[model samples]
Target: MGADTITRTNRVTALAPWLLVLPATMAVFALLAVPVGSTLAESFSNPLGVFENYRRFFASDYNRMVVLRSFWIAFATTAIALAAGFFAAYLIAGSGPRTKRILILLSVFPLLTGVVVRSFGWMVILGRNGILNNALIELGLINAPLSLLFNQGAVLVGMVYLFLPLMILSLVGVLETIDQDLYSAAESLGSSPFGVFRQVTFPLALPGMVVGSILVFTGSLATFVTPRLLGGERQMTLATLLHEKAIISFDWEAANTIATIMIVLTALSLVALGMLAKRLSPKGRA
Candidate 1:
């Protein structure tokens, strides 16, 4: 065959598979069409086709509190997880191969326990006469038992412990690719390890940190399991409210409204994070 003809044939073979992805595209659109349609319908409707749903959502203090609590928990968890995960990933990244492997396995520790099982575990350790209290008492750190269960503190601890692995793995993958030669170069040029990390390594790894935080934040925001079991009756996060309204209270309007609010808040958070990431990125032009 002529070389030009052969080249054209090879090019066509490479493009053929991508051309066959039409049905998969259609299926995704089909999957999306239902919920998108339903949400729109619910958002616009009322019991008498009035604007009462939107009004109730905006005016109700309880609903507002639920939304606020959800975001607060999510943001706090994401921030704490990012800080702790970055350091852990740095340690793993700096370690030898065997140690790195062990650290990677340790990253899987959270996955070994189910959310319910983990929540129960937290219940045991954080209860009024919990292990933590007993240890503190034994050490004379506290004069009395501390109430650790059924509140924001318990929720945050569960969340950080639960989703932290994702952040660690994300940062480790990025940090592994970084040039350690850069660190040595900075040190040789009179920069301390801390200075090198602050001025060099961190900016490069910042994108991964942002990604991990976003994932943790979104997951926590959409969380139904942990908060429900851990946060308890007074916590009242949006996800819990959604479940309560949709399933228990059978107020589908309120449930859908809460779901829509969550979607909007998540989208806004991602957009804001993207902007912040861009502003801080060396490669990005302000």
Candidate 2:
């Protein structure tokens, strides 16, 4: 009886973690896995063939253009956000505690508002007679209001703005974790400011950069509201195309196909970035 009781106790202890996580596992299966499985299954459903929808999508010149444009925009947004966010994060990390709190609050304030509201704000600023054009006109920068709205540039601007905070926050979290002693040691060893940053700060911060890049890239690729409002019909992206297929045309097959492609693209990007992160890691260097 004593031996049996001990065995039972050990088994219970081993299963405790699994039991605790069961609710979350079930919720994920029901909410995420089920819907994603349904979408993938529907994407494969076609009277003609399994690959028919995918074939049709890639065969269309317009679809190809939209996919390429989406990738380009995502890449550009990730690049710009990473650069700017890193700088902002470094500044925030080095600031006094009260100033850091204020800066972080300002960074997070934009995220509290809805994407629709933010996109509309951009529209007001970028319109022909908008605040930006008026300011430029007053300064004699141009003869007339330049066309800024409803273009790829507008979309890029909106995307960068929309995702910049996420990147900055990710980088800030990592930057704060870095040991200040390392900087002191480097300086004591006669390392220049840029050298210290290059040899110590950047390598340690690569993980945050990877995380931020993934977030910004995936968010930019999946975003609909900002691109729809800023890019207009002329500068269509994959997300916009998915919306048109699903909502306007009522084409479930095409919409599902587009969604599947997006999922695959996002997954591939994550995997690629993960591998790149490992390669760039300090341990990997040695």
Report the number of the highest-TM-score candidate: 2
> Which lDDT tens digits does candidate 1 get at residues 63-105?
7787788989999999899999988998999899999999899
**Cα lDDT of model 2 by residue, 1-286, tens digit:** 6999999999999999999999999999999999988998988888889988899999999899999999999999999999999899999999999999999999999989899999999999999989999999999998899999999999999999999999999999999999999999999999999999899999988888888898999989999999999999999998999999999999988999999999999999988888888888979731
Question: Model 2 off-target regions past 4 Å?
Answer: 1-27
How big is the positional error of residue 250 in model 1, measured in Å on the Cα after superposition? 0.7
Question: How high is the CA lDDT of each candidate model?
Answer: 0.86, 0.93
- TM values, all candidates: 0.85, 0.89
What are the runs in model 1 whose C-alpha is more than 4 Å off? 1-27, 30-32, 47-51, 134-145
Q: After superposition, how far is residue 116 of candidate 2 from its true place, in Å?
A: 1.1
The C-alpha RMSD of each candidate to the native structure, in angstroms, is: 4.8, 3.3
lDDT of the structure predicted as candidate 1: 0.86
